[model samples]
Target: MIKEKKVSSRFIYFFGAFGGILFGYDIGVMTGALPFLQQDWNIENAAVIGWITSSIMLGAIIGGALAGQLSDRLGRRKMILIAAVIFVIGSILSGIAPPNGHYFLIAARIFLGMAVGAASALVPAYMSEMAPAHLRGRLSGINQTMIVSGMLLSYIVDYLLSGLPATMAWRLMLTMAAVPALILFFGVLKLPESPRFLIKNNKLDEARRVLSYLRPKETLESEINQIQEAAEQEKLASQNTSWGSLLSSKYRYLLIAGVGVAAFQQFQGANAIFYYIPMIVENATGTAASTALMWPIIQGIILVLGSLLFLVIADKFKRRTLLTLGGTVMGLSFILPAILQKVIPDANPMMIVVFLSIYVAFYSFTWAPLTWVIIGEIFPLMIRGRASGVASSFNWIGSFLVGLMFPIMIATISQEAVFAIFGVICLLGVAFVRIRVPETRGYTLEEIESMEESRQAKQKSALLERAGL
Candidate 1:
């Protein structure tokens, strides 16, 4: 039984976060495919390239919203299964899109975006629900690890396939997503539903069984009772909960904290580098696309290493501290590149990659993974699903705008100017974290919610005293 518990817990965590692999692969695959696709299609329009790259984010916005509503009604596990199916279908459609017609490819990518959006919102929530509070940060961070692993895998695929004919190379890079989507489908099929969900649905026996697989025998009963108590209160509060509940002044700080972290995670300009690094490198140094592909692999390795480090430190430190330090470093990294380019016009372009690596090192361990971790932790259970979805939409909104505008920005202003703008955003992110985001480490979801309520009460009392009430 002890061995079974270990195996079951490992299985649950691995597959629970496995959806991120698909999410990362789809996001990274485009980096390699775009260079070849542009050459093959003889495309020169920056807007078209931006559309092809960013269309998935647009779809993700919709997917995140829809999945949030549905997952609340259905279950986290079931929503993942549904997303896996969408992943398979979308991957195939994306691969088969015809040459010279951006519309079909864009449409297919948008279809795939639904799965990406769903995974973004679902994986962290699912993992958090299943994990013990002490381990939630590390366990939840695994989704990010899986995401970067998938990205590294895609970068390797892109590099390996770079030598093939342009059309064939990009096509194969996309179609390969189906393989993992199928794996996610089969893998998730056997996993138990979240114990929290079970308790919410009043399945006491099943919740006990699920918790047994996750928690030790000593704590299993107490954990289940705790979850039940939270669920009972959540059920009462949910009677008044709706999408509008997020806007209530009582919870608005939580909403700001969750959504601000998510939005800043993207607006820091990380994806802009991920999606267009080759182009940036090529335009800067006139390097061939094939040679430029090697850089992503280097960045991917750093990201993976940083993610590994995050697992070690995730539960040890304050979330706000890590984010503030990371935001500061990331802001500086971008700012230095922009400043150097302005100061010395003939500076080596490779320095941009160096600074970016510093940025990625901080991001992989900090804002990238912790955003989802905090989002999963901060919301009230009654509104976790909808609020998470809304936060995700804001995240994708940042991603979509960055993806679409980065190229246009590069074309109009210089790369240095664009980098400067991203740098400023990163610094602003630090301010937001310090002022608004709560310290969520080592707290249960119930505890975090209560803490937020207390914080809200304090703020209200302070306001009343100031108003002479």
Candidate 2:
């Protein structure tokens, strides 16, 4: 009766995007939890601290790869349900780990980390598959908006709980993820499996039924035909489209572009601000981490705003153009502080905070959301699962490196210098988009692959013409 009692399109997209909250909450929860962790556990070793923080990224690296392959075989919905279960169990276990259970805490975080990475990879794909081509960007963009909203929620929770005793406060912050994880579990159950996934698995009738709810009644037949034909052509091109074949020459460019954007999105140093911005603020202002609290809430608000803006215009512009514009502006935001510090060595430390806020504003609309959109939409159906997994793993790897290294980088060098390096990386990211990334706005996944094929053929023709006898 789902066809008759089907929810509105807004409900479907909102529920689909809910998984992102699981990832975002875990990401921001640790930021609030870590300060209390140091005080409650009396931990002082920098390496140990870095390990605890980065362990989630470590597990995420593994989980993204595993979920990619699992979603391919088991279907996206089932894999997502599995991830939600993992988050609940992990969060509950982390809540209880204290008083000489440091390793246990790390292990629990790894479990949650797996869930985070899986959701990060799966939700976008699921939404993109269900949405019509015209709405895919905005629908997939809902995932990013939910992600920042999750971050905002965690920050609000942290601020509200900042006054409680350290042990009780941090435990609550870490366990808070279970609430939304449970919500997503129940929510996804009401949804149909992705029509494309159903088609690929040869459940054509089921795909037709799902599309009856997802697409216009008149377009359902042609939509099914188009989806089926695309899968058929991809299957004929390569029967052995396993994870190992992603490295093949034909797919190498996509894998590279996808993974490159994913990695640089992290390496550009946005998370350093998210995870350790309080610490950065503490150092700059010569105050306790507690005093650094109000700023993150401000950040959370700006992040939510930028994501809201993305929701409005995501499908309105070409991907390459927006990404290029965002990167240039974000680069300037980072570098301008260093320039000011050099021009006046006694520049108000708060100037750095203002610049970082601008950076977040730019990030929310551009790299923050678009990276997920491109990763979800760029791959052909045959390799989407494994390729997205690989790309996501690289993203977590960059996140891990930044989380582990940033504290040390700040301890050893001037913080402005570190941000300047990130500025250079951002400018370089703009070049990567201009040269390597293709325009993907408003294109069907099948048509995107065909476009790539045509471009490759033209390049080959040009090479041959230049060497004509």
Give me the candidate number with maximum TM-score.
1
Given candidate 2, what's the lDDT at residue 16? 80
Candidate 2: worst-modelled 10 consecutive residues by lDDT: 1-10
Residue 406 lDDT in model 2? Answer: 86
Q: Estimate the TM-score of every prediction.
A: 0.90, 0.88
Q: On residues 373-453, what C-alpha lDDT tens digit does candidate 2 reach at each position?
A: 898788987787678777877888999999888888887888989999999999999999988887778887788888778
TM-score of 1: 0.90
Report the lDDT of model 2 for residue 292. 74
Per-model C-alpha lDDT, please?
Answer: 0.86, 0.85
Overall local distance difference test of candidate 2: 0.85
lDDT tens digits by residue: candidate 1, 96-120: 8987879999999998999998887
